[model samples]
Target: MRKKTNSAIRRWMYAMAYTAVSAVVLAGCGNGGNEPAAGDGKLTVTATTGMIADAAAEVGGEHAEVTGLMGSGVDPHLYKASQGDIKKLDNADIIFYNGLHLEGKMAEMFEKMEDKKPTVAVARDLPESALRTDPSGAHDPHIWFDVENWISATEVIRDTFIEKDPANEGDYRAQADAYIAELKKLDDYAAEQIASIPEASRVLVTAHDAFGYFGDAYGIKVMGLQGISTASEYGSKDVSALRDFLVQNQIKAVFVESSVPKKSIEAVIEGASKMGHEVAIGGELFSDALGKAGTSEGTYIGMVKHNVDTIVSALK
Candidate 1:
């Protein structure tokens, strides 16, 4: 299966290469209509994920035209950029992405583009002391799970924009300040909401280990069927082990992530049920991506609030 998947990806890459070249040539011919022309007074910023795009849009305000490549329920770890995305990246005045290998398949491409454009990894410059390491000793890429950490990422975006477009530094700073205050409120709300779950039941189980930072911030115990990245697969033994843990601890609920398949969680549910436990799917959580655009869950603050509300309602 892995081999077949890889082969398919290779074919896709080959196909995209042809499309990418044509896109670049076409873009050059028309000055890249996707981006604002020079003297249009707006910076063209492209972000890798919806969360990053939200931050850019809020901070950049009227000074930037922001575009995100991956949208709701999109998994960055396995995502491969399409030719159109390459064109957008090529024309962007600034590009922001969550680093620390979050966009695993696209990391190499970003590295290559760094010298060609103002590409910044919002999470990469964070103090190592503040980062959590996975079992493989790599920093966990889901830093947005912690509202405070996400605020730091926004600051990084603000700084990057200031450096790239100095004329709009003041605007960026003002918007960032406002956004930071709102994020503080969001952080407080998440803490208050999660606090409602009884201490004995203050445990979160999800499709993958994307909530380590969240659990750390809110004092909840989190378990995941798979590893930090959805790229990791769980076998029958892994499911059985989790089932035993749930059965012994009387954990009543587990969650499905927006970007990950529910099969593993379903398997665990079945395993626990067969063992005479009645475990339920607490709710769906936006782990790796936000909800659709224009919806409340589409925004970062709204996404966090939705997640906490879902968790509290189910586990309380």
Candidate 2:
């Protein structure tokens, strides 16, 4: 699990981030923001998760240095901060994180630092009307999964990045324009492909709650055992509740997230079996993190496409 940390150090000789990472697998760290004597003049940008980091990279290109707080297959809800992470936050010029309770443990910290930095909530940029709501609160925070929502959110990111670093304003705008075009193509392709699935079979059931946005935008009915945050556990009572639904609704298949454990989902499966409802584990879906670096499901666009393709194929 910790094997990849050294590889990134070979790329960046500045800081060893593994010591601060609670999750064994981490992305990258470097001599970012400022130097000890003379600041590197590079703008220090911090994102709470890999998805946000990837988006910033797409928009900022090489104009900025971003730190992804979460690593491979790590859940953002239960993330804990380390001493080095605190130092990174202290040095940050701007911060981008998924709001709407996605960062359950870090909400207070982000809120406290809001006045100190230009902290933007990418998911919150989507129109409230376009958001999917539940008893929990505002709406789903996984808006990045849907291309249209992401297109809107990217505007927020691009604008915020420009506001912080105006010297390379033109470059950031150009990148945003190009990236937005790609995002539009992504949305169009998702609509065309997901539409092919029969409407009746478009029910998506997952281990935890993250797909509300995907289902709302793509015409699938979503169900999950836990709430939006992974901080909550799937207790015996919770498992019993979802298992009962699976049996009654005759859900075709269930899903397990790549970042979240398979056990919670496996219990759902086991419950179904005991109740005589034989539901298959549809396929491993990329929820929080992007897939392996070079796979078809690696990029944000590809990962979502792969997920939609898998869900449609399994159900329809």
Candidate 3:
């Protein structure tokens, strides 16, 4: 049995965050309009997740001191800020986050900081037509799954850095152009690799629906036990339904996300087995977060390549 639903974890985090935010609001405690640069005069930036942090580093180049709040395999949806994280945010000259409610528990805190700091949501300004929405019409915050969307986000980060530190505008623009060109190549690579999978077997089932953008971009049909947000529940009915899907389509493998528990996917595998469909665990994917700081999958391009290669190997 699953120990706890992602929704349960998120709810608990939200309560704790609400209490913390309330106290902070009451005391009016936060960094008050300090644009203090880093030790070497670079802007100090704090991002909510590894992906956004990577963007800052790529666009800011040596002009920003970047820090990420969430580490490898950390789920952003349910993550709550610690005292240490609050300190980082307070000291940062600017903050970047995925937005679209991706950081469910910390949205309020980010909102509070918008006025005091150059807090930007990289994906929030994207055209709605480019975004996928949930059944309830909320924009899906997993924009990083699509390489092109990620390129757009990188540009957003670049623009924000330029706006914050106009003196480094030339460096930021140059870096942004280089990174964008690299992402274009990455997009082609992903498409080529995904095309290697047989059309009939191009169905990607994972622990959650974080890969919708990937599927849309690469022509794969994505299915997940939970909804767009891991905060959604997956009951026995969901499991049985997904099991039937696997059996019907003769799916050979399902994937597990780094940031989501494998228990839900394991249950799906077990359910498929009972119905006579032998499915394998394809590979671990970086969904809501990236890999370790020094690893290959630590960078956005590398992470996407690893995921594409893993999917192609399992499904081809």
Off by over 4 Å in 3: 1-38
TM-score of 2: 0.82
lDDT of 2 at 315: 84
lDDT of each: 0.88, 0.77, 0.87
lDDT of 1 by residue, 166-248 (tens): 77679899999999999999999999988888999999998889999999999999998888888887899889889999999
**What is the TM-score of each predicted model, taking all chains together?**
0.90, 0.82, 0.90
Q: 75 in model 1: Cα distance from truth in Å?
A: 0.9
Which prediction has more favorable TM-score, 2 or 3? 3
Could you give candidate 2's per-residue lDDT for residues 189-302 as a string of tens digits?
A: 877877887887777888888888787777788888777767666799989998998899898798889988889989989989998999999998888777776676767888
Give stretches of model 1 more than 4 Å off.
1-39
lDDT score, candidate 1, position 97: 90
Stretch of 10 with least lDDT, candidate 2: 22-31
Candidate 3 per-residue lDDT, tens place, 1-316, comes to: 2557877898899889867755664345343443338478878889999989998998988888999999999988888788778777777888899899999968877887787767889996679899999899988899999988988899889888877788778999999999999999999999988998889989999999999999999999999899998888889999999999999988899999999999999998998888888999999998988999899899888899999999999999
Which residue runs does candidate 2 get wrong by more than 4 Å? 1-41, 294-296
